[model samples]
Target: MTTIVLGAGAVGTATAWYLRKSGHDVVLIERQPEAAMETSWGNGGIIHASEVEPWSQPGMPTKIIKWLGKENAPLLLRYRAIPHIMRWGIEFARNCTPERFRENAKSNLHLALHSLKSLQEIGAEAGIDYDRATRGVLKIYRSRDSLDSAQRSTDYLAQHGLLYERADPDRCVELEPALKDTKSTLAGALYFARDEVGDSNKFAQGLAAACAARGVQCRFGETIEKIETRSGRVQAVVTSKGRIVADTVVVALGSFTAPMLAKNGIRVPIYPVKGVSITFKRAAWNAAPTMPLIDDSKLFGFVPIGDRIRISGSAEITGYDMTPAPARVAAIIANASFTFPELKRYFDISKSKVWAGLRPVSPTGTPIIGETRIRGLWINAGHGHLGWTLSCGSGRVIADLIDGRDPGIPVPPPQGVVVARAA
Candidate 1:
């Protein structure tokens, strides 16, 4: 059977690769001229299973309320987007209970750990290098309470084979000497030894190339008009070029997945949460931290890619607005600089790149992956901030389901994901 995969970002490209490997003819479609030109581009580049907790944790409601309208707040909810996101916001808050938060974190951690392994396997087999680094990720806390909370979370995740070590301020500095400047302010840090970092866009492009080499038809620069469905199954995908018939279709269009399926009366409950990242060219390679670092207090992180450093985080509840707000960008840089004090000296802002992409977030923080009520239609979106972290594993699961095999992973379907019974 021929499968048509929509969106050529990390998830879609990985899906196409796995589908072709599963002995199916696949066509990968992207509106951009190349792959990973959307959310997959300019990401934080950290793949840490230790940070798999959902954003809708127990105390998120209070935090959101506190951060409301704060320009430099880690998570900002735009008043203008309230009406548009009223339903999703309510559902998100509903999932903020302790029970739901733990469940969602476990679900996300399973996929994230699997994805890291999948990435390693793909890298070994395909010999694709995206400036991959194995120095692990260090998440620092500014408050003793936060550090203790993280230690508890790490202990819980440790049961699942994710290795983490609680480090004091001095140990953190020893782990990443660049953090020496922040020793006075830091309470402690958690280092996930198994986590990895790499350029997600480069990985997506490399996987797309591998898919093409494996005879997967990659049709880029084509806009998908609609997905025609009848009799409870996908029929054909109508693109700007023409209609292409397929036995199955996978929607991996990130934030656009929900709306696209809605036209066909399918609601996936995916919302577009905007995030910004700023990449600066480093003056000296040794001047920056070699390992990825996340500031737990500020909810931001700094990732080193070759001679550049990318500062990413800060969620804005704006509906589909990709505008790189100057203040938001500055906030990211400012927050990241708290950890790396010499950031301004080493960073060349003139040569920096600022980007904003809509993350397809779900109420539970877990991605909606697997077949829907529509027999031949599948979804692998709503990964939120962890899209790059979970792409390969999610793709593998989608392929396994389509091939009539167990995905061998715990993939609970999202609540209210079922569309009206297919006619």
Candidate 2:
């Protein structure tokens, strides 16, 4: 069968790769000149399966309310986005209950672990050189209360085969010597020994090349204008270049998936949560830490990719706004420097690259994958902040469903999300 995979980011490229391997003629479409030029680019670079809890945990509403409009706050809600955010906000709030959060975390962790394994296999099979490291990830907390809260979640994940260890301040510095400078501020840390980190853009590009080598037609720089349907199934995709007929169409457009599918009478409740990242050249090989580190108190992370260090974090509840806020970018830099003080001297804004991309977040924080209500139409989107972490696994699952085979992973429709079906 011929299949058209929309949006050639990590998710779409992975989907195309798996589908071609499954004996299907695949075509990948993208608006950018190349794959992974958007959200899949400049992410935190950690495949964090151990940290799969949804952001809408208990007391989140109170935290968001307290952080609203604060300049250096971790989450910022723009006033202009209020009208567009109301419906999604209501659904998001409804999922904030403790019961719902745990259920969602369980599902997310299942996909995340599967994705890490898939990524490793792909890297080995394709010889993908993405500066990947299997040294695990360290998440440090500044307060005892925060560390205690994290331990609870860690314990829950431990029951499901996740390997982790709690580290005191001295042990935390011992794990990553770069943290030696910040020992005064650190309280404790949790290390996930199995987590991995790598450059996602390089992985996406490498996978896309592999897909092309396997006879998948890649149509980059073409904007998809519409998805045509007939008799309750996808017929063709109308693009700025031309229309392409397909027996199956998979939507992986990230935050843009909602609007494109809405035109086809499918309402996917994905909100555009904007995030920022800055990548700078490492001063010296030994100056940066080898392992990925997340600062839970500051809500940012530091990743060493080859000779470069990526400082990324900060969630802005803005609607489709990709403008790079200098303040927010500076805040990320400052927060990251607090954890790795040497970063202050090495980070040169003139030479560094800063980026902002919208994460297609579902209220429940679980990705929506598999056949939708429309026959021959499928979705593998709304992975949110875990898009890179879950990309390969989600793509494999969608390919399995497209081939009418068992996905081998649990995939249920997102709770309380109202998706319109075909008549």
Candidate 3:
């Protein structure tokens, strides 16, 4: 079977790599000159299942209201420019119900845990190194109320096979002595020992190389023009370079998957949620922190990749534009400085590069995976904020669907009609 995969980000590359391993002729298409030159680049590289809570949780609605006009709000909605942002806001609020939160958390935990194991196995088999670290993830809180709330959510995740422990402020400083001087800012913390971190861009590039070595045709710098179908199955995918005939097509185009399908009359309710991150060159550490750090109060996180530190967070519902906002960058810097002051000397402030990527977000925050209404076409997008964390398992599940094998995990029901569109 020949499979055409759209987009060459982490998800797309992983899909191609696994599909090729499944004994299929895989051709990966990308709009960029190289794989992972888009959203998969400059990402917070923490692979965590325990930190898999949806953003639309109980305490978010009121907080969003308070943050509306604030310039540095962790999750900002630029309401002036995007009126449709309100619709997403309404839908997001609807999912904040206790029942929905619990359901989404459980569902995400399933994918995150499975994906972590799959990622480890794939990396070992391919002998791919992405500066990997298994020092776990520590989420620190700065307020008592916030710390208490996180405890409940962490407990919920831990109950569903995500092992986590509540760490006292002193314990947090002990885990990462870098936090010793900042002890006054800490209220408490939660540590997930199974969580790991690495460079997502490096991982994607490594996997792409592995796939090519396995006879997968990774077609970079090619744009997918359209998907031609008859009898409810994809026949061939038309691209700017040429027509790619395939027995199956997997729409792993990240945030663009929903819009591309909508053109073909598929009503996939996926939206682009903008996110930002900055990478700093590492100099030296008296002792490098062996863990990823998340500041709950500020809603931002920093992950170590060898010597460099990557800081990322913020979700703005501002459509397809890739414009970088200075205010958002400032907020990220503010949060990062508070978490790790030593980064100031190591990274040149003026020389630092800022980047923003649109996350393919679904209303429920859980990725829409499985067979779609269109035969021979499957979707593995909408992982949104958890794309890097969830890609490995999603690739395996998507390949299973293509191979007509039972996906070990329970698959979600098919979504409604999907309209396909040209890029």
Candidate 4:
């Protein structure tokens, strides 16, 4: 069967790779000249399966209310004229129940772990390098209250077969000495030794190259104007270049997918949650920490990618503004300096480049995957903050469904009628 995967980010590229491996002729389409040029570009880089919890869990409503319009809040919701954002936000609150949180976390963990295995397999098979490191990820806390909250989350994870070790302030320093500067303010931490980190853009581009090598046609720089259908199934995709026919099509267009699908009468309920990242040249390699670490108090994570250091965090709920906000950029730099003061000189604040990307977030915090109401149309999107971590597994699942084979993971029942492009 011939298939076209939309969006050339990690998810779309991985989907094309797996589809080709599954004996299908695949073509990938992306608007950017390069793959992973958007959300996959400058992520925190932590592939943490154990940390698969929804952002909308119980206490989130109060927090969201408090943080609305706050420049440095962990989650910011900025809005204007869109009803989808409000709709998604309301449903997000609905899913904050304890029951939904546990269920969603379990499902997310399964996908995350499976994706890590798939990622390693792809790395070995394609011999594609993304500056990956298995040095583990640590979530550091500065307040006792924050540490206690982490303990609860960790206990929940432990109940579901994920193990995380509790680390004292000294142990945290031992694990990541670069954090010694913040040791005095740290209350405690949690270490997930199985977790890893890497460059999302490098991974996507590498996989795209591997796909090309495997005879998968990648149509980069192609703007998809619309998706056309016949007899209630996808017939062809209309693009600026031309109309491309396909037996099946998977929409993985990230933030843009929602509106595009909505135009076709499909309400995906995926909203764009903007995030920022700052990548700097490692001026002090010896002093820098090898392990990826998250400062929970500051809501940011520092990921070491070869000679460069990526400090990324801050979820801004502004709709579709990809431009970097100076305030947010400054916050990331200031937060990094607080944690690793030894490398303060290495971090040239003036030279720090700011990048912002939108995360396609769904209400349930789990991606919408499976055959939609539209016969030949499928969806494998809305992985949100975990897109890079869950991409490979999602691709495998979508490929399985396309092949009429049972997805190894339990198929989530269609939550509701998945509307298609209106006539």
Give the TM-score of each candidate: 0.97, 0.96, 0.94, 0.95
1-423 per-residue lDDT for model 1 (tens digits) = 889999999999999989999998999999999999999998788887977888988888898889889989878999998888888889999999988887888888888888888999998888898989888899999999999988887687678767888899999999989888878999999988888889999999999999899899999999999999998888999999999999999999999999899988888888998899988776665668887999888888888887678889878988888998889988887877777778767766678898999989999999998777887888889998999999999999888877777777787445677432211
RMSD of 2: 2.2
* Candidate 2 local Cα displacement, residue 25, angstroms: 0.9
Per-residue lDDT of 1-423 in model 3, one digit per residue for the tens? Answer: 888888888888888988988999888889898888888997788998866777878878898777787778877766774576566667778888999988887888888888998999999999988989998999998888888987877777777788988899899998888888688889889888899998888899999999999998888888888988888878889989888888888898888887788767786767887898887765565554556898888778888888787788888867887877888888888777777776665666676668899888777778877666678887888887899999999898788877777767755323343332211
Which pairs clash in the backbone of model 1? none
Ten contiguous residues minimizing lDDT sum, candidate 2: 414-423
TM-score pick, better of 1 and 3: 1
Ranking by lDDT: 1, 2, 4, 3
Winner on lDDT between 2 and 4 is 2
* Candidate 3 C-alpha error for residue 153, in Å: 1.6
Candidate 4, pairs of clashing residues: 264-420, 264-421, 264-422, 265-421, 265-422, 266-419
TM-score, cand. 4 vs. native: 0.95
What order do you get sorting by TM-score, best first?
Answer: 1, 2, 4, 3
Model 1: residue 252 alpha-carbon error in angstroms = 0.3
State the C-alpha lDDT per candidate: 0.87, 0.87, 0.81, 0.84
